[model samples]
Target: MPYLNAAAVKAQDSPGIISVGVLLLFILIALQILNVLRKILMWWIRLLWWVTVGAVLVLFASIIYQRGPEKTVEDALRGARHLSEVWWREYRRWEGYQNLQQQHHVGTSQKSWTSRW
Candidate 1:
């Protein structure tokens, strides 16, 4: 019955309460460390994402360069000039053919009219 007094009860319970407080403090420290680790992990994930994006961009650019119409501005200009020249040559040839056909048709028509008369 003496141990049941208020002072004895308080003294007896103090050790358990102090131990619980210490345990809670350790848990708080552990949670803080976990939070820091989570932040670091997120940062690394973000960095990796950017690196992957950069790599994809490089790959896309290389593919486009490889498969594009012309490699450089100079090449494009040269291609355009060649195309224009070919077009002009074809146009002149077509015009010459048309002119020769007109001349042949006129000559035959005149001979036919003379022979008919």
Candidate 2:
């Protein structure tokens, strides 16, 4: 077997090393994008949650103002339960729409990369 000198070894390994480096860079970039997108979505979710709670509190305050505190507690409790059920159902419906859109899109290649592995 022939020995690989330093220059010969470097030449032999350069393409593979470069390819790996490029692949790593690509993956790192993809991860960064995903992280940013995740943060943005989380921000939106938080904002929506706060807004929903704030709106409910305002509505409750209005109800208390209009009807007084005596009979409002039971009504508020029932409304809260119904509101939670409706909120989750609507959220799931919206999520299903997004999933449907994702599933129906046509693709040339590697479209299901996340699921492929």
Candidate 3:
């Protein structure tokens, strides 16, 4: 009978099998990309979550541990002013020392000393 032709049946089914295999390969690639994206998103979320937690902990602890708002602000202001003054003094000293070195030509490069002479 016409339906009993096994070779014809096998040939007809081969194309369908090939198409299914190709579709499966495409699905596998899509799944791999999806997994990679999920991992990256999870890592980023974890980093942000920890950073936020640390910041909140620091802020809350400072507020609870400090004596009062006025003390905190005053201390901060005082520290800032002291730091500014120290930096300014240090800068002036550094500039003055540099000027002295320039005048005396102490510890200068050979080329610069020769040029100066």
Maximum-lDDT candidate:
2
Q: Model 1 off-target regions past 4 Å?
A: 1-13, 69-117
Model 2 bad stretches (over 4 Å):
1-13, 74-117
Error of 3 at 106 (Å): 99
Clashing pairs in 2: none
Query: In candidate 1, what are the lDDT values of residues 1-117, reduced to their tens digit?
Result: 775687567857688876787899999999999999999999999999999999999976886688684555566678899999999999999999999887997877555455676
lDDT per residue for candidate 2 within 1-117, as digits (tens), equals 245576567767677886787899999999999999999999999999999999999988998999989779878789899999999999999999988777676533436667667
Work out the TM-score per prediction. 0.48, 0.54, 0.45
Predictions in order: lDDT:
0.84, 0.86, 0.85
**Lowest lDDT block of 10, candidate 1:** 108-117
RMSD of 3: 9.0
When summed lDDT is taken over every stretch of 10 residues in candidate 2, the lowest stretch is 104-113
Best candidate, TM-score: 2
The collision pairs in model 3 are none
Q: For candidate 1, give the lDDT.
A: 0.84
